[model samples]
Target: MKEEQKHIEALHDIKDMMNRSSRFISLSGLSGISAGLCALAATIYIWPVWLAVREKLRTGGDLQVYPYPATDVQRLLIMTGIVTFLTALLLALLFTWMRSRKTNTSMWGSTAKRLMTNTAIPLIAGGLVTYRLLDLELVGLIAPSCLIFYGLALLNGSKYTVSEIRWLGICEIILGIINLWFIGYGLVAWAIGFGVLHILYGALMWWKYERV
Candidate 1:
């Protein structure tokens, strides 16, 4: 019996080593948590501005949500988004690096490169599409579009990381599709997709991986 158990353990270790070599498994849940918090903070700070933008789009004569903001308020809102994204990315990188150190994993590897490439394609396409939407003043679809694309990116990259991310991607896609009907509530949907979903996924991952 002991011999059998030893053989099983060896098999498990071999499997684990193979997984680590092929996948970037050192991603920290704290990264997601920090990102979610940053998104929520940005959402809160920009809520009023979003409200005004929605009102303007609904009533303003031009009815054009240009790539460039027409008002100081709108510009500030844009800045807020940029800042939030940068902050989240910075924190995420920091946390991931910390985890990689703890696990003695290489932060830059073929697996990580593949993950980034897969994730970037969707995000880059989404950015271009979003700009076109703004040019056309189809502001209502922007939030849903972002959610969908981000979810797709997550799905694309999830194969290289934790399995939990795929579920998060699915949830984001579902929420984005549902938000299509609630066009007036783009900000709310954005919060739910980016902020709330991140928090839930992060918490679950932390509980499962980090708590121990």
Candidate 2:
């Protein structure tokens, strides 16, 4: 019986090792937290610009937020979005890389490539669709589409990583769907979906996985 138990334990250890090598499990919850903070800060910074544009248009009796914004304002908004994305991307990569190092895992391996490929497909599709929407001036749909596609990407990639990500993705998709009816509050929805949800997910993950 003692020898049988030892053999079983050894087999279990080997199974765990194989599982670790095949999956990218070094993701840190701090990465999500940092990304959320960056998103929230960007949203806070952009809120005033959006409000100022709305107020300016209101004075001219054009209170609708969907109308194409002034050229400078439009450019500013686009720049802000790009900067926010880059910042979040940078923070995520930094934290993830740190975690990988701490775990003595390769950050750029076959598993990572698979994860990225699964994630990028929906995002790329969403980006192309959003660009066309912007061209057609259907800007209201942009936020919802982004949320939905991001949720889908997360869902697609979650199979390769932690299961918690799938729940986050579901929440995001639900929020995006609801936002469709509330187009007037697109920015608010975006903030909640990207900023608030990320923070919550990060906190939960940290508490569950990182805390003693």
Global local distance difference test of model 1: 0.84
Model 1, 59-169: lDDT tens digits are 655433433347687568667878988999999999999988998888998888888898899999988997787667677778889899899999988988877899999
lDDT of each: 0.84, 0.85
Top candidate by TM-score: 1
Please list the residue runs of candidate 1 whose C-alpha ends up more than 4 Å from where it truly belongs after superposition: 59-69
Worst 10 residues of 1 by lDDT: 60-69
Q: Which ranges in model 2 have alpha carbons more than 4 Å from their true place?
A: 1-8, 54-65
Give the Cα-based TM-score of candidate 1 against the true structure.
Answer: 0.92
| Predicted candidate 2 versus true structure: per-residue lDDT over 1-212, tens digit per residue | 99999999999999878868777777788888988888899899999988887566556553333567788989998998899999988998998898899888899988888889999999999899988877776767888888999999999989877779999999999999998887657789889988999999988888887775
How many clashing pairs does model 2 include? Answer: 0
lDDT of 2 at 44: 95
For candidate 2, give the lDDT of residue 16.
79
